[model samples]
Target: MSGSLELGHHSSLHQAQDSSKCLDEDGRTKRTGTVWTASAHIITAVIGSGVLSLAWAIAQLGWVAGPIVMLLFAVITYYTSTLLADCYRYGDPITGRRNYDYMATVQSYLAGGIKFKFCGFIQYANLFGVAIGYTIASSISMMAIQKANCYHKQGHNSPCHISGNFYTITYGVMQIFLSQIPDFDEIWWLSIVAAIMSFTYSGIGLGLGIAAVVGKCLQLHTCIANPFLVFTDHFASETENKGLKGSLTGISIGHVTQSQKIWQTLQALGNIAFAYSFAMILIEIQDTIKAPPPSEAEVMKKASLLSTLVTTVFYMFCGCMGYGAFGDDAPGNLLTGFGFYEPYWLLDIANAAIVVHLVGAYQVFCQPLFSFIEKCSAKACPASPFITSEIAIPLGSNRCYKLNLFRLVWRSVFVVTTTVISMLLPFFNDVVGLLGAIAFWPLTVYFPVEMYIEQNRIPTWSIKWLCLQTLSVTCCVVSLSAAVGSIAGIINDLKAYEPFKSSY
Candidate 1:
């Protein structure tokens, strides 16, 4: 038994060593398509569903407040991400584990037992949920484009609808097929091709759509009316009773008032939080990075900086160009149903992009869940059923059948249960808001505070530093309040929109 255990450990080490070699070779060669530079990965991560919704979200915040909020959120996101990265640097000592695993291991080492389990669970939960949500969203986008295309072909003026079940089934089947592909080396090339196609389709479609809208805008006599400048004129009337009048009034009094700007800034900050999933992706892929432990910091730093810059530029361009072109009517996702009527080629590209994006998202979402399940199952039953049965049972015993049956039943039940919940109550934006608010308070702000307090048992602060800490604490308190309020607002919105008759 000891010899078998040793053999298993040796095999695992061999695999890791081989993986490290592959990464080193891939990293060294620019042409070796296996390696993804951090910038590319960041761009791919950030330019997901957020780009589609930014315009609409910003519109809600108003023109002047929107861009400012985006910029502020970018800064806050960079800071928080740096903090997370720093934690990663501090936690792992010469083990090439990714930040997510490092975080889990660190918490386990430092806190132990339930605290470790809970942290690890939350991290996995968030990763799985976000990945699934991204896939679902991308699928929805694809369905929208398909429906739009059908409507256009049929010459129908009505909006199109696609069945959610159809999409889910189709996506699942594709994922299963993709999973069967054997080589990790091949996937990078596919990702690159997909990335290029996605970029081309999205860029051209968005450009043409924007040009059409801008041409229309230019034709109007009101071309001189800057949308940003018109905020004060429109703000008071639009938000008179929407609970923002006082805030608008204060903003009107002072252009650079910190208090007035803080909320808007934080809203942008929340956008950053929404985009922070990209950083999580880096952490997710940390195990695959080939760099030595000592060099991980430099690698991570370069990766984070490059990735952030790429994402920031993409976001800024999309936001600014999108707003500039469509103004108020610009649909959040550049591939809006309304825009399909404008031309055929642009529509086709958008449709193709949505399809590809959805496909990619499904792969990303399923891989992690599948990997986690495999790991858990392997831990529970380390020995192969054939080997275990041969060793433990009498020769020609039929008891092996019972164990196999139990394993099959258990796995089936687990899969079915997870599938049901995911299909029925798949939480997207507003539902996500509720979950995040509940989780974010404890996980992001409170947990960090507790961790810092527990880890650092010394008081080596000067008066100036102490004052700064106090101010920082004050900011966190205010931010927490705002987050809670935002959650409440989302809940109220949901309630207001609920049906008159409930089946329950």
Candidate 2:
């Protein structure tokens, strides 16, 4: 009896060890990312070439309104992202039952029929639009760097002009390969690097702007003799043409009417919302947090707050400084805009950082969409070899061939499609504005707030609920107004361009 009891105790101990090992592996496979890595991912998603536009955005709103609106968006985004983080817990907290992605959360909280379908469609569309925007921005960044290098080496009028399409196609093709990475967790390192790059260029740009301002105050004519300014001055003698249009400065408040100011303010509001937009991938990123995911909500809350604080400070600094430096004539893209011809090396570095950051941001937003499409593809072609289960593939046989072929074909086609669009509509800032206007309220405002109310079972007439409802309605109106304005702006831009002309 003693021997049997001793044997049973040892056997039970071994069983417990095995169970613990299984749990560890399961957790590892489930949530492969940590708090800081996830925070880096959030930062990468939020900050991008969008920051470049904040200066222009602030210009539209003037100094006082810009920072306030941006901070307001920051607060709203933080609260909604926290609501989303909390909803990641499916049933139990400590038990680790969780919804891994945004769609899953939507499916759980929102209704099934039309609501769920619309949610999924909009969510995926927003994410896809974001990826396309990144692709477009990456190409533009590359072109800007190339142009700066050429002008530095040669002259501004050098015949070495590279077509923007060339860079767009190049970056798009590169993304086709990079997008093949199967999981979000696999690219946390990329996000970290991208996040750092965002801060680096932002700091550099702000420093450069402040330096220019200080030099101006000290009447340092040497510092203001930038190639861009020289070009503007030289071209001013000629007829009014596209090349000679100089940057705008000052409030110029007296020049526009009240209606125009309100319209511009609405547009600026939309752009600010866009600058803060990252909700489509919030839950997907949150899912990367390591389990037991009961704490994912808290982790994500902290991460979102950290990212928001950093980005808001950075946005305010860049926007205010850039506006102060350039005044009303701030370029739509602060980096690529006119008057940046000098300091080729610094410009090149900043644009390169943007390119690298956009590459990672593209993947961060696209991975979820890619996963969704792949899943649908597998379901549709159930009998295809590429769609086989692990057990069916056999241990010794190579299963990667069919999978790789599918990835190559699908992702390449997607990249090519975006490349074509970028080439066709080379209006970079206008297109970004349109995308933001269309997607801002739907993804960033309505869905999150509504889902939060439903998930928490808050009464519709309650103060919290009514406040969010009013905000959602307000966002909707603002989004519509901005969309119309953006479309008009794009139309006006197109009138100046002949078909297939190299915008660069």
Alpha-carbon RMSD to native, per candidate: 10.8, 6.0
TM-score of each: 0.63, 0.82
User: Against the unseen true structure, what C-alpha lDDT does each candidate score?
Assistant: 0.48, 0.72
lDDT of 1 by residue, 20-53 (tens): 7655533442122113554466577566655654
Judged by whole-model lDDT over C-alpha atoms, candidate 2 comes out at 0.72
Count of clashes, each model: 2, 5
- Which residue segments of model 1 deviate by more than 4 Å? 1-36, 89-105, 151-156, 159-162, 176-194, 197-209, 216-272, 284-295, 324-332, 337-340, 383-504
In candidate 2, position 348 carries an lDDT of: 88
State in Å the error of residue 480, model 1. 6.8
Instruction: Kindly provide the TM-score of model 2 when superposed on the true structure, using C-alpha atoms.
Output: 0.82
